[model samples]
Target: MRRPDVLVVGAGGSGAALAARLSEDPGRTVLVLEAGPVPRFPPGFPAELRDARLVPGAWPDAPTVRAYPVRLTPDLPYTAVRGRVLGGSTTVNGGYFIRARREDFDRWSARAGDARWAYERVLPFLRVLETDLDFGATPVHGGHGPVPVGRTGLGHPAVEAFRAAARELGHPDEPDKNAQGVPGVGPVPTNSAGGERINTGTAYLLGALGRPNLTVLGDCSVRSVAVERGRATGVVADRNGRRTVLEAGEIVLCAGSFASPHLLHLSGIGPAKVLTRAGVPVVEDLPAVGAALSDHPQVVLEWTPRRPVAEPAGSWLGGALHLSSSGGDHPGDLEILQSLVPMAGLVGRRTAVPGRPLALLASVQTPRTSGRLRTVSADPRVPPRIDYGYLETADDRRRLREAVRAAAALLSTSAFGEVSAGVVEPASLDDDGLLDRWIRSRLGTSQHTCGTVPMGRAGDPSAAVDGHGRVYGVSGLRVADTSILPAAPLRGPAATAVLIGELIAHAMCTVR
Candidate 1:
């Protein structure tokens, strides 16, 4: 493929959505290059990927998955799992599809100097990407769109107790958690419409395959954006050991937070010193391309429910609770999630505490600590080094410690009296020091990675991309994924990633 109107690298959530939206304009041709295989049939996407009960795609050793090594601490190394299939990490994720908080957009707007990124401006783009089945025709939700989002719908006894417990603690029950900035306990809105997961490939790419102007080339790894004279012309991709220069009028990097910056560095578009050390020639010395990596830090706690769970085999996550740490009127900075399934086997090689049948996860929504992504080599096949730098800051440790304490309190509420027997971990939450030690040992990723190639005001030296996903010091090259996020949103980044795809497509189309 040569000289297409637009070339999109990595057909993950953002790339697939951008390609589909761009193809709607019949005058322009779009090509999406993906590192994973095309999930041609329903069976092509593995049963584990379809099952919401298990995070099979999260297994680093899984044959179908690609896991990156992340150094959470200097002594501890954890695997950051990303799906290597058509829909990217969406294929392997738990399918929690909630929008970013309004403050997230407001923050982006203040930094990027682009009001288009503000909550009111970006909400329309979010609406264009989803067909909300549960909350139809709301002021903040879309009634009809490609991706179908609805409540988990599965009713479990323990989940009901959890919600009631939240209400007892003064957090009201929100009918739709995705609605206009509601901080309360409610059923998790999932991307799964029926039983199967609704990923980007299923929602955006599959139905649009018949479009003549759109082409999806899967099982292809994009080496780098082919740049000449400070402008991107195309990408160098390798498919089955065959290297090809797929040229385009405009190149969009949607390889995600980890891969997007890696691709940029490989193409000589990152910090000059790092590129030189990696034996790559420098094209543009942008200091922040692979910097400022951020993800939600979470600690999982298991409990022993005294009564039998109604449906243990059903959906794992029954509901979620969003609360503020400062007790102010802003969106929640802490999230406590309930999972009906046992998650002892999920974390790699952890001793399982017996008698714990239920899982409760607490995540710090706005993490103060950030990390970096660096290249081991110039080779695209070589996975980059990921250091999440979790809980490095005094603020992060303090907030996360408080979050753990909050989760423990929520479990001990009167509502859990009918369901839970007692806390299964730490032996006792009575000692603050013991609970803090337990939290640090068990902290894990919420799988919401963002802010590597962050978007900022054009003049800001730390900004990799300008307000509208265009990389600094490079033309015709833009990043349209979670990697472009300036910070981790209050909720999961998937829905916000989709909104970004829509917004960027609109920008690219009008620019053309």
Candidate 2:
């Protein structure tokens, strides 16, 4: 077994970014273990995966798509979608390149008691992760970086109408959604340029393929961390039916929310009860390893267009509207995204359309309900039991109801009179009780899972890692993905996940 300077698990967005930045030293050996096949570089990736124009599931959910069964309620169960490929979900996601709002960072800073996680402190890392084509030269945006970001052009009349409808409802038109302050209804910056998805693998890994110091092993499934004498050692992985123990001086978990926590528990570093139930020897009694799973549960509304819409064959999500569900001080709490392609299936909406269809997806920005992921068995073959516990709180339900109504209002505006014929789904919008029921039955995750191994204050019992991403009771082990987010970011997690990799890579280099 050869020990590398750094072993990064999961060669997705953050994992790829971390590996690329760490390998920059040329002196340090960086090994990336990806559980999925190595995807082709941009312009060469599969048409289904590389096309930025459609929502996920444009292609049939492949074997690489890990659909975890999630218990949304006691009686209801749904599948949470995640990509098991090199680029992770970024390959399949809509490529909405939104940044974490100022409030999200401020709240994290206050809760984690680490000012370094504040908005201003993290801005540089965010800037270093993207090449913002729209707001490149701005004070808040970045010019040259790995991920290529560009404004999703509003070629479709329905999409343009949706943005105008938002503004008609008093929401100002924001030119760049990824810029500072609250986002308004306008063009969203996406991680795609020239109709190709630019995931971390495309941006960070492909260019660094020639680096001798970096070794990326695709189709390698890591079974567990190799902990020795209360310290991190390496990992045991199964590659093509062959088991191998790869030693590492340091292990960084970039396996996202579900896998990162599952990896920790498999390594005997989770709740004692969970470990005992799973028949694994308890190495560390970290209660927070698989707890506090959070995500933005969304309700989608589909509308039939009276006329034809000329849309490009790229991203469906071109523009969005961010406003308050409660109409309170927090205006960035609800998000309504406009999609030229049909996205009703994502939220359990099924109806035969009379004409061309468009989508408006409304989601609670910050959810109050939290869930957990428990190891079903010691065998990695058994997927972890995940309970999103969505809409469990009164506030969440109330906000979702408000968001649904807001979506309806946006479509009703005169701005959409030419494109939109009528709202086609959600039969219970008029009645409060029926609308709540409809939302509960149809709500789905935005695929932005986070906080399964949340970072918090050092002494906090729920804190799995410190603000610096160091595991509390473990040495030489860290987490640098959405898993370490104390809560869901204000928007999507892809860009933030890449930023986290940059921050962690910088910290690792500075320390050694």
Candidate 3:
């Protein structure tokens, strides 16, 4: 096959968006290679797979004990979950949309020396990618965007109760969380259209599949990037045991945070010692490719409601409380999410005649604990070692405990008092250590991994890529995905990943 103008690796949220954008010009040849099969949504998904009570290890696509087993460090017991399908983790994530906070971007600009990444500049790209269902009159959101963003129509009973309690607790209800830029309790804006998941594969790749210039190949695992004279020429991929070398003028790595850096290392682009130990030639001595990883650590507070609140038996509620950590002084630095499901004990048994089974989940969004991702072996088939390092700091534990107290206070309110029975996770209200024990046992990844290949100024050794996402020592290769985030945001990473793809496509177009 001939060389394409651009080769996009990993047809996840970022790659799909980039492929669709490049196909619009009808001039450039774009090739997208994905390691997993086509995305499958609900209704077609198995009933067992849809059960929320099952642990992360039981989920078919979960990375825990399935395809990509996470190697948890002693400090943290949580497993990291990431999807391997064409749409990537977005296919399985709860479709919540949260724009990057201005404060968060300000920190990134100062730390990374990229003033263009300030929230003001990136907001336009975010708006361009979304078609807000509630508020489109504002200039920040576009009405004709390919991806549809809207509110939830059928909310779980626990969600409604949680919202009422939040309002009673002096929190104002936000009509549109995506609009007005105010943090409060209300329905989360989702990336769904008509109650169906609108993952990147459905919204972007499939839409552009008809174009002749764009070719999408699924079930093709990339072995390593092909580099020559510090320039990426193509990739060495294995399609079900068949090896082939595909060439490209420019290469873009959109394989989530972990895979992208690991793939680069396999291609001899990471730390010198790591490649040497793995018996791979050193193409570039980039020491920061897999360092400085960060993720949100969640401590779940579970409880059972008193009354049967019309809760759906087999559905999941994506409701959450967006609050500032400030007791009352400033906007919150943390987020509290609510999940309504049954307990593992009640999975197979039916609820009693008088009392129905239900569980309430409350979690902290922005965690202080930091983690790292490293290559376990040079073999591309082996998953990388993931050290979540959850609750490794006093701040993380303190904030989580505070979040639990806040959630318990909300449940005690009149709105929730009418429905909730008692706490289920801690099992005892007097035990102060119960929350800590529960968190260590049930904590898991929210599937929003990032910051493995961070972007910053040239002098920063930890910064693997430049502000424009170009690798430090490699030419004709760039990374335009969540891996480029200097710091993980407090909300969903999907919207930001798509925005990165759009920004990179625009940059590539202007550069040529």
Candidate 4:
């Protein structure tokens, strides 16, 4: 087996970004192995599918080329979506691009004992990888970068109404959410340029494809990380029914939250009980490999507009509202995102009759409940058990209730009243209990799954990866995707994942 300088598992957002950065040296050989093919936005796919692919479900839940239907459990009424394509979830996520809140990083640093992860320290990496469209003599943004960033156009009428409603609710206009540390209602910054998705693969991998040192293998599923004597040497992958061993000096797992930890367990790196129960040998008794899983659980607050102010069009809305919980001083707990999309089914199902369009959207930033992903079978092909313990805490329920109230208040404002019919979520706004019931029934995931392989101090038993992203108790192995996030940051995880790739590339270059 020929060894490359680096072998990246899961050529998603993080892997693509890392590959692009490492290829810049022209001397280091980087091999990216993807379990799925490169995603091409075919014209035949439904508009809803395209939009949902951008928002959620970019990662295929099944191990096939076709997109499969996702089923939601009782606890999590919303669909669980993931991308199986080369670009990963970024290819299918809503392009809403917002940086992680300073408070989020501060909390992570305090909890993980890594002061270098402070907001100020991470900003340089964020700026380097981003190309802010709203940049011009602004110190807060970078204009000349690979990743394009821009705002949605001001053509939508709902955008105006949303902004007016925010102002009416005492929220100031924040021109740029990516600026230093401000949060308010403004145009959503997206990764879309020229009305098309600019995913990580497009921005990173595509640009580096000409490099001779970088080898990209799509449609190849990595079965397990090949670990010998507590060190990762390469991976065992299945490509077109043929098994092959791809050797590398270092192995980095960028397979998102669920898959990364599952792969670790498959390679004998998880809890002894879990590995033993699955009839697999336990190379390490790391109980925290698949623990500390967290995601943003949201509750939909639907409302119908009275006068047709340009009826709801696409799931992608131009404007949004960022509100903090009533009790919390920092803007991290809960948020209210207003979208111009009707909610009828798992995917936005629209009716032909043009009576009035419904707008249903919610943001649940602070979640009290956490879940774990455990392998049901020792077979690498079997899917892991996913239990999203939604609304399991009084705090989660309270925050959700508050989020609904906030959404309702925004709709009731004078701005929305001009074109809004009435409330649709709580049917009867007077009763809080009724609203709570509606919340529990209609709540779903925001598709931001993270925190499975948390990064913390070396002595921390729960920490799967170290501050530098190297997997603990294993050499030449690291987890560089959302799985390394100690917690889901305030903003979307895609951009942060890109930053993680850049950080990892720099770390690897320094060590080499």
lDDT of each: 0.82, 0.82, 0.71, 0.73
Reference-based lDDT, residue 112, model 2:
77
Q: What is every candidate's alpha-carbon RMSD to the true fold?
A: 2.5, 2.4, 3.7, 3.2
Worst 10 residues of 2 by lDDT: 345-354
Stretches of candidate 3 exceeding 4 Å from the true structure = 39-58, 61-66, 71-78, 154-157, 311-315, 326-330, 343-357, 367-369, 427-434
Q: Between prediction 2 and prediction 4, which has the larger lDDT? A: 2
Cα deviation of 426, candidate 1, in Å: 2.1
Pairs in clash, predicted candidate 1: none
Compute each candidate's TM-score over C-alphas: 0.95, 0.95, 0.89, 0.91
Residue 65 error, candidate 4, Å: 8.4
**Model 4 C-alpha lDDT per residue in residues 88-145, reported as the tens digit of each score:** 7776667667777887777777766877678888878888888887673255777777
Error of 4 at 318 (Å): 2.4
lDDT of 2: 0.82
Give the alpha carbon lDDT tens digit for every residue of 1-512 in model 1: 54689899988889889999999989889998888888766577877777666666557787556788888766668888777788887887878888888888898898899999999898888887889988776678788888888886535788878888888788877778777556888888878766668788888988898999999888888888899999999888888889888889989988888889999999999989989988889999999887778889999877888865654443567888888876454458889988766676443322232454677889998844388888878877788888888877766777787777777787889887778886777576667667667877887889899989999987788899977799899999999999888778888898888888899999887864
* Model 1 misplacement above 4 A: 312-314, 327-330, 345-356, 367-369
